[model samples]
Target: MTKLLLGRYLPGDSWVHRLDPRTKLMASFYYIGIIFLANNWQSYLLMFVATMVMVALSKIKLGFFLRGVRPMIWLILFTVALQIFFTKGGTVYWSWGWLAITQYGLTNGAFIFMRFVLIIFVSTLLTLTTQPLSLADAVESLLKPLRRIGVPVTELALVLQIALRFVPTLMDQTTKIMNAQRARGVDFGSGNLFQQMKAVVPLLIPLFVDSFGIAEDLATAMDARGYQGGDGRTKFRILQYHQPDIVAGLAMVLLTVGLVFLRA
Candidate 1:
């Protein structure tokens, strides 16, 4: 099973990894917007190609993106199946009683699945390239404008940083708990769906308790360090955009335009 990856940064010297964190963050948001605009297979295909280019630039294998998707594969498959079953339009390819699969449904399901894949790949690329600390800095910088409106940007960034930092830890905790349960003859993967869900309650209870315990420990550690708000705090590494960052921004702009044009 693929565990969740929150801020799993893979260090590299490639151009994608070298861009300023803010650039990557903004580009990610823009990419998400463009993805929602895609209404055709051609647009989604182009977007997937764009994502692959980023993967190549970041010096990561395509399998890296696919690996994290194992856990979600069931969800994706279910979603696509639901879309195929529910959507009613166009020619009916297969009919059984009141349940009919139409050409439109197949098209919609395929497009939605592609959209999901592209978004997942792009977001994973962003986190894989940018470190958690850098992401915090970028989020703080981006949210600075909201500070004047009484937004607690620093606190929000801190929450985000902590959440990202603990994703792997929580995943590890879940794995250990599951393993222990399985050893004791807990059938998490067998039986009917309801029975499987009942088995998960035991897992969730302990996981939540441990999560809270970890959160309390984190708070205590931060308090022990005399941590305060980011009023006058300075970063050890400063972010500065380079030529490659600008080029990447321009490329994103072009990609967005192309997706818009390609939308059916």
Candidate 2:
């Protein structure tokens, strides 16, 4: 759980880190489109290559990104297992009454897993490169046009900001609670499934209590700092698009085109 890196930011001087948050945000959507557009092995390979290029541009270690993927490993496997056993049709490989495996099942299962992996990889890159505050601002800027229709973007942005901000805090608290429980001889990973769940219950209570306390503190601090919502707000560090952002944006476009061609 501690290896989970959603909404966490790491500071770096890489061009990916320095690009306009809006451009990065836009590119992320296109990248996600590529993930869905991947219909064959060739398309998947192309997407993988493009992602590696982006990772190189970010200047973050491949291992660092892989480490953050640890938490989702079980989920990916479970999903694959589901598809492999339940999906019907195509050549049957094995069978046991209601339980069966087929070539179709295996192929679809692998595709789903690869799709999830690609999504996670790109998302990890986004959070690792973009700071939380910058992400919030980028979101606000992107949704600014929606204000013409009265979307209440400020409240939405605040919610997103708080959600992103608490991910690391919750992760830290989870680690601490686990450590404290371990010290008390609570065997979290021992015994049956129910027993493991029982051990986790003790950890959750304290974590929730601490989380609420921290949220209260944050609200109080914001109130003390005169946070009167996002109306008429001014930015200290304004966002600006540069040549690198344009070049990166163009690269994303070309990558998307290549992925589409590969899929076709």
Error of 2 at 40 (Å): 0.7
lDDT of 2 by residue, 1-264 (tens): 544444367789998999999998889987897688888889888888888888999999888788767889999999999999999999999999998999889988999998888788898899899987888889888998998898999789888878877887888889899999899988988899999999999899999899889989999999999999878877676789999988988888788788778885
For candidate 1, write residues 1-264 as lDDT tens digits.
232344367888988888999999999988988788888878888988888888888998888899767768889999999899889999999988877899999999998889888788888888899887898889888889998999988788878877877777888899999998889888897899999999998889999999999989988898899877767777676778899889999999899889878987
Candidate 1 total steric clashes: 0
Residue pairs clashing in model 1 are: none
**Whole-model alpha-carbon lDDT for candidate 1:** 0.86
**TM-scores vs. true structure, each candidate:** 0.73, 0.71
